[model samples]
Every structure is written in structure tokens, then in C-alpha cells.
Target: MSTTPQSPAPTGMYTPGDSSAWSQRYADAVMNTFGAPQRVLVRGEGARVWDDEGRQYTDLLAGIAVNCLGHAHPAVVDAVTGQLSTLGHVSNLFTTPAQVELAETLIALVYPGLSAAESRVFLANSGTEANETAFKIARRHGGADRPRVLALENSFHGRTMGALALTHKAAYREPFEPLPGGGEFVPADADTLRAAMGEDVAALIVEPIQGEAGVRPLPEGLLATAREITREAGALLIVDEVQTGMGRCGAWMAHHLLAPGIIPDVVTLAKGLGGGVPIGAVVATGQAAHLLGPGQHGTTFGGNPVCAAAALAVIRTLRDEHLPERAAALGRRWSEQLAALPGVSEVRGSGLLLGVALEEAVGHAAEVRDELMDRGFIVNAPRPDTLRLAPPLILSDADADAFSQVLGEVLTSRTTREARA
Candidate 1:
């Protein structure tokens, strides 16, 4: 029999020479909002990834904490493939089984005591869209006259206009001045939030753990106090769990751990929800849920069956594998180990999400990250002095040990060199 000629592998497969071509293509086609990409990643398995250069690295960032189960997870893949084959997209005019199931699942997970009549779910395509829906719901609940939104300082909701208005970073908000009149920024403290709360305020949005601001968790009593204050003021307490939800913080939602009794009027979820399929949801309770009627808010691709199927798989995998508890244990272990290392001043955050603060303000955090990548580890430097780690919940003990060992060596070497310098 004549042997069939094998087709050539894709251009980006395991070759450094092909990296430039991919980067050039990316530059030509994509916007420069994120600057140059770090490395041309080819493929991944579990928490490990192979770059275009054939170099292997343990991915600690996990696509900015979006990959809860890591790369190419069998469950996620199977769910998406199966759903796409059977049914993928349908407008809001029609409801799919996956969509309804996901909504019910999220409602059950997010609000245990709340009944269906007291709450509702609105699906979207990203974290920003989820927040946008929440914003709209809050404004509607508060009526037209009182549409003010009180958000915390140093918080990052999303990049969309309405969500951007509530985001407090001047660097991000300056360029887009006069965003929306009703958005206001308050400090993270309870007293500050209470002072900001009034009849005019529609909602108070807070992140249980602020991800982009170096994994700063809100003070223990702060979230409960926010709920009380908002409730008394008749304003919604909207928790943005985009980064901290879906088992990332070792819990279904970070707010659940922070204040179990306090149920937010609105909760926005994304990031790890679909395990990389791109999905966002706004879970509203009480009157807030009833604010959005038909035609009030809508999206073309939101709640696509494929995304819903992916999310259902993610939720099921998290439960079946008990990934949340694993995240809790591993997070504590990793944080403790990293904190004990030399040159590491502090370690903050819960679960798989962590931020390591360097003693000497490592101005070259990016350089350290590059070096770490060379040494077969992947991580992120959110600030000059702080390194954020959000590895997959599926990351093995061996992987964690490898990271700790490498990190110890790097920190010691850097400390010694700095002392000499």
C-alpha cells in the first residue's frame, strides 16, 4: 500500500523561530492595548504550557485566573464539543436546557435561602457585561432620580464605559473623563462606605478580594458592614466576584466566606465561570431581580448554549473533584511557603489566589518573571513590588513544590546580589 504523506504541523508548534511570525501577525491584527504579548504559547496540558520556543513552563497565572481547571481540560472540551454539535447559539427569544440549568445552578450556589420568585439570572458574555447588567438593574431598582453607584477605591470592575465609571483608578478613568454622572468612589473602609450611602445611592459595589490591586482582601468585618449599610439605605450590595468566584478563593464565592449571612442584592460573576469559554452572569436577589423585565436589557451572544454547557461542566468538575477545598489547602500551603522565603516580605490572599510582596520593592518584577519563565515557571507581576499567583486548582503538589523550590532559589540569589550591589 502507498503511504499517505503526513501534513505539516501548524507553524507555531514547538519552534522559537516561528514565534516572530506569530508575534508579527498579532501586532498587525490586534490592538496594542495590552502591549506586546509575553510569549507565543502553543499548547498546554494541566497547569503546564509549551511556548512557541519548545520551552515548557508551569502556568501560575492561569490566564489571569480564568482557567480554573487549567488548559484543555477533558471535561470542558467534551462539554463544549458536545454542546456545539447538538446546539450552540439561540437568541433570548428561545431558551435552551443548558441555559436554564446553568442559571438554576448558579442561583442555588449563590443564594441558598432565596427562592426563584425572589431572584433572577441575567446572562452575558464577559465580566464587564455582567457588571453592566448589574448597573442597569441597580439604576432601575432605585428609580430614575436616584441612580448613584458607590464603588470602592482601587477597584477594577471592567473596561466597559458604565463599569469603567465605577472603577476608581485615575490612570484608567482619566482618559475617559465624564464617564457617567452617577458613579462615585468610596474608600474600602466600612465607615467611609456608610458615609457614602444615602437614599440617592442605588448600589454599593465591592470586590470581596480586589485582584488587580495586589490581591487586597477586604477587612473581615467590612463586607458585613457594607451589607448592613446598604440594606438600611435601601441600596443594593453588589459584590463583584469576577476574579474571586468559581472556586478561585477556595469557596464558591469569596463573599460566602467573608459574610455567610449577608446576601447581596446583586452579584456579578465571570472569569472562571465557563473555564475559558467566556461567560458572565448577573445574579440578582429580592426586588433587584425584578427590575429588569423583557426588552429592558438584552445581548445577542449572551447565554449561548455552548457557553452554558461549558459552565455546567466547569461547575460539575469543581464539585465532583472537590476543587474548592483543594484550592483552600494548597493556597494556605503556598502562601506560607512563599512568605517564609527570603526577600519575600508578605503574602496575602486566600485559596489559589495569592500575592507575594517583596521586601526591596522589586522594580524588576517583570525581569524576574521572565527569568522564572526561562526556568520553567510562569507567573505575573501586577505591581513593581508584588507578584500575583493564580495557578490552576488542578495544579499538583509536585508542581507547587517545583515552584516553591525555584522561587526560593531566585529570591535568595536576588537577595544576595542586591546585598552585594
Candidate 2:
């Protein structure tokens, strides 16, 4: 008598092999936060993916540096599927072996010199959420005495309220007025940072290598200077490794790679931790580890068994395969190759996380990115003049060489067009 579409509306079904139809359906059902879908990707494997129309692409962006192991890696797949079948999930009231092991493993691996007693891990659902947790810790640690937090200009923490407050971009902050407040932006320089440091500061949060700001590395010794300043001022130093961690920059954490022995009070991590599965972590050390009391912070699905298992598998695979060392070697060689391109001005960043700076006459990064897309390579332009390539750590040398050739062709075509015009 009653027909409610049986809980599966006609519009709910997606059309096979038709990107247009899927796009229409997506517009009707999904929010327009990310605008139209790029290609309606169907599946992926080993740094490559196919869209609904069957056009394939080499995923050089690697889901914005989140797919470190590439798409559907066997280790991640098996770990996720197996653990999901066995334990699946449980509330924070209880703990799973995977959860405990993941926490321990992160401390042992990422914070090598620091002992377990001196460090702790708090897992969350995304880099944003992990940064949110860190924000709370900073606030709690500072209390009423220290009210200010420092973030860099052009820095991107996240979109959430707390994290967004720390993000220094006006476009992302102005619309959302009266934010959590107390967040200030400072230039990434030792002198500027020391001038900003004071007894009123709670923490100075920074990305050792600014990923969104065109893969820019902070001036050498700036972090060590920050370490000394924050220490002397009794403030916490939070390193955000969301975009540069888990071997993306040839090390477990970019801070360790850049600063060596200079340890921070807190380290926020995500993106590549679960390879592809959603997971994030906050690594706090020394007295900073005990800042958040029991009931002060928690997450519903942060370190659930299945996600934890996936993260554990990712860590194990990265270590076993020596992927970090591979990233360093391959990235250096490939960077030199890209830097040699006529249109490229500079190749910034280290290891696999690189941002290629484009020359004025060659064309803006967006146009070049589109050209690359047409040629079956997927990359993104975070800035007008820069193209970021964060291919999976498993990227083959042959693929890297092939990509260089394709890029050469694309730039050459642009050059030819300009000359004709």
C-alpha cells in the first residue's frame, strides 16, 4: 500500500560508464564544498586510477599525499579487511590490541630517541581533528596565563573552528569571525619568531616544510631557534607534520629530519598514516604528554581497531620495504630531472613531496596541470605558479622518467604556442 521507494530512490543509483549522469546525481545529492567531481574515479592501484569513462591516469598527487602506499595496496587491504572482519569497532570505553600497538608503535618509531615513558599518542579521525586535539592541549597547558598561539602566514591547519583559528589565511578566517581567538601569524624566520615569543604565548605551531605554501622549507636552524625560544619562554612547540610525515619527506617526521635532535612538545600527524584509510595521531612528549586529563578529550572513531590495523600495516610495510630511503634517492634524481625542464624555474622541497615552480612565459600552474591531466597525469596547483607532485612512495623509477618525458612534451607544446601567438 505504501511506496517509499524501498529506501533506495531512483536517483540513488549511479549510472555505469557515464560521468555526466554521475555528475548530475552528485550535484543533486552531495554538497558543493569541493565543486564538481574531477573525473569520478572508479578504482586505483599502484599510483594509477581509472575514471568512470575508463580513462586512466597516473595519480601523481596521491590523494593530496595521503596515499603513500598507492591505491589498494595489498598490505593495507588485507590488514583493513582482516581486522574489520574480526574486531571491526568498539567504543573508547574499551581498547583493542591494534589500538594499543599502534600507539606504542608510533612512539617507538616516530620518536626514536624518546622513551615510551616520555611520550604518548592520541589518535583522531583526520589531520584536522588531530590538530583540534593539539589545540585543546595547548589551551589546557597554557590555561589563563598564556593566551596567544602562533601560526605562520599562509599556513593551513584545517577548516574546523579550533584548527581554523590557527590557520592564518584571511579568506579562510575572515568569514568565520570571532573564532576561538588568540591565534597570531608570524613570518618563518628566527628573528621574527624570537620577537614573537613571550611569556604570554601558549605554543608556536609550524610545519617544518610548508606544503601548502609551495613546499617551502623554513630557514635552516629556525626550528632549533624556535625550540630554544619556546623552551626559554615555557611555551610548547607543536610541529604539524600532516603533509610531510610518514616518509613523504624521506623521514618518519619532517621535524626530526630537519631539526635532528631538537624535539618538540607536540607533533600532529595524519594524511599518509593509514596509507588511505582515515586516521590521525597527536604525539606529545615529556610533560606535554600529560597535559590532557582523562575526560578532557576523546574521539568516537579515532583509533578504532580496523583503522589502527591499517596504520600498523602501513608502518610495518614502510620499514620493511625501506621506502623512506627509496623516497630520498628517487626524489633527488627526479627533482634534478624536473629542474632541468626549460619552463621550470625551481624545484622545491625534499624527497617525494615537491613543488615545481613555473616560469612566467610557460603558463600558470593550473593550465599546465590541465595539460598534464590531458596527458594522463594527475597533479594539482596549490598556488598560481607552483605544481605539487606527491606521488606514492612506491612510485617506480620508470614511471618517474616517463612522467618527465610527458611533462617535457607538455611544456614544449606551451612554448611553441606562445611563440606562434
Candidate 3:
């Protein structure tokens, strides 16, 4: 039979030879949730990525702050590979050394100087899952009388049913109607937050730095005030540190930057915890730690050994490399330099997590993002006028300086063109 000689089997990775072919395949095979594929990324190392056609770019978003050590870090790869060969997974009915070790590590971070017994961890697989666990804890602590939950106006917890209720974006929440636990959205101002902390409020969930909301950080003492207010009202305080935790915010947790004596009842973490491996955790302290008892809440693959091992490696690497301190220094330098750019209005955020607000005359943030991509940079424009940068913690000062120079050039060109227009 003249079997059509199957076109000589292609070599190397399954790249369609160009981005358009991959985009078409993605449109046909994948869900359109995130719109069309931006680029068919093929490989990455450190803070850089290469697309299907071999174009390289500096990855500034770091998979939305999930890649703390950047892509293909040896620590993460070794941990994951070694753990899988030893013990890939064990159901929640049993525990592994890696699982316990990671939990202890995270608990230590949550309550430094105290025994790990002071806190409890429930591991999940994503920030949304962690937030969902925290939501259930709130309900369990609140019981029937306390039905109301509080969240900030510009907050973004997650997209799951329970987390969706807490997220303040109308577009994200409106479509997913009748979300499971009802919650009230309020401004992050201390006075408004205090007023919202009534007896019926089950819990007040807040992000130390509202990442999706243009990287807007809460006023320095807002979290501490939330702690006091929730304590007086007998309500739980849940801090969503999904994007700001794991050394992304110049500290182990962004809440650490808040005023002293700010202890959140429950803290949700994910994104960078596993250094790109999927993992999330709800670390509960004080009475909240005891709220979810045996058989109350569980996940089958939540604390799988492989993911735990990866997280432990990530933690060790962060400390060994002193990446958090590096992030702080680079963040300050870039913030100052970016703010001085011609078409930049302001810079917001802490550490490597940052947002640059463009002057109105500079045109749409989407256009700027495209221009940056064309010039070998990848960033996130979460809003019409804002560009967010959550580069890998390993980003070198030279890369930061390079970004600044390119950004200055782009801004100056845009301003000159806009002035003429």
C-alpha cells in the first residue's frame, strides 16, 4: 500500500515552526479562557524565555510571580526529580517526610521563634485552592450567626466559587453569579475597614499588596489595624499572600512589612512556594489553626511528596542565595529610575513586584506591552494605564538596568509621537 510517506518525522521539540501555527492549534485544542495565546514559548532559563520561532525575551512577569527562582532552576529540578524517583505521591491518609518537612518550614515562617506546633498547615495546589481552604475555615469559625465576609474593593482572591465571592472585580464575579459565601466589598482605608468589622462579619480577607489591582499596596499599618479590628470583633483575619509571599515582597511574607504585632489568623500562600511546581498552603495560627479538625477539610493530592520536596528546595535556595535582599535593592533602584521616565506617572509596589503607571498621553498600556515585547521584554499590563513587573527573584541588576534603558527609550518615543499627534 502506498502509505503516504509520513512527512519525514520532524526533529527537536513539537514547535509548529512558527507562532501562528501554534496559536491556531491552541485555539482549536484549548479553552479560550485567557484569550489567544500570546506566544508559543518553547524554553526558558533564569529570567529569559524563547518563543517557537527562536525569539528571546526577558520574562518580567515570571508567570505572574509563580517563578521565584526563575525557569529551570537546578534546585527546583533536582528536588522534583529526586522526589519523584523516591516517592512521587502518597494519599492524604499517609504522610511523607517531604510533606512534614515543608509544612514545618512554612509554619516556622508563619510564627518565627515559636514551635511549629503553634500553627497548622493545609496544603492545596493553587492560590485559589489555598483561598478556598481559608474560606471554609472562616465559615467554620463563624458558624450560622455570622454570615457576612469582608474584602477590599480592588482585591482579587481567586476565581473558584468560594474565592470568587471574595474577589471584588465585577467582571470576574458577575459572570460567576451567586458565589458560595456572601461577602461585602469595602475600601482599604482604615476607617472604612474598621466600620465594616461588625459582629456579623465572619472574616476580613485582604491582600498585603493588592497585586492584581495594579500592584497597589495597603497603607503601612492597614494590616495591623485589620488584625486589631478582627480580634475585637471576634472575627478571623485572612491574608491572601498568594502573589506576595515566598520572598516576592522583600520578606518571607508581605505582612512582615506591616507594623509590628500584626498576626493574621490565616494566611494563604501559593505561586512561588514551590518555585514553579504547583502548590498552595493555608497556614493557620492561634485558635484558627484548630478550627478545621480531622475529616473537616482535605485534598487527595494537596501535599504530595514531590511538590513538597520542590517547595523545601525553593525555601532553601531563597535563603542560601539571599534573593529577597537582592529583590529589595533592585526594586528601589528600578522604582526610582522608572518614575523618572518621561511618560511614567508613578511606580508602586515593593521588592520585585511592581507597577508602573503611564501618563495618560502615552496611550494604552496594551500598546506599550506590545512594544516592549517587540523590543525583547515581557510584562503584564493588568490595567489600561498600568504595567506590572514581577520578575524572577534571580533577576540581575544588569537586566534591571537594561529594562530601564529600553523603557526610557520607549516612553520618550511615545511622548514625542503623542505630542505631535
How accurate locally, in lDDT, is each candidate? 0.88, 0.90, 0.90
Candidate 1 error regions (>4 Å): 1-20
Over 228-341, each residue of candidate 2 has an lDDT whose tens digit, in order, gives 999999999999999999998988888878999988999999999999999999999988899998899998999999999999999999999999889999999999999999
Q: 90-196 in candidate 3: lDDT tens per residue?
A: 79999999998989899988767766666999999999999999999999989898999899999999999999999999999998788785688999899998887
True-vs-predicted CA distance for residue 208, candidate 3, Å: 0.7
Higher-ranked by TM-score: 1 or 3: 3
Enumerate residue pairs that collide in model 3.
none
Per-structure clash totals for the candidates: 0, 0, 0
Candidate 1 local lDDT, 189-299, one digit each (tens): 877787788999888999999988888999889999999998898888999999999999989999988788889999999999999889999998888888888889999
Query: If scored against the real structure, what TM-score would every candidate get?
Result: 0.95, 0.96, 0.96
lDDT of 2 at 279: 97
Tell me the lDDT of model 2 at 242.
95
Given candidate 2, what's the lDDT at residue 72?
Answer: 90
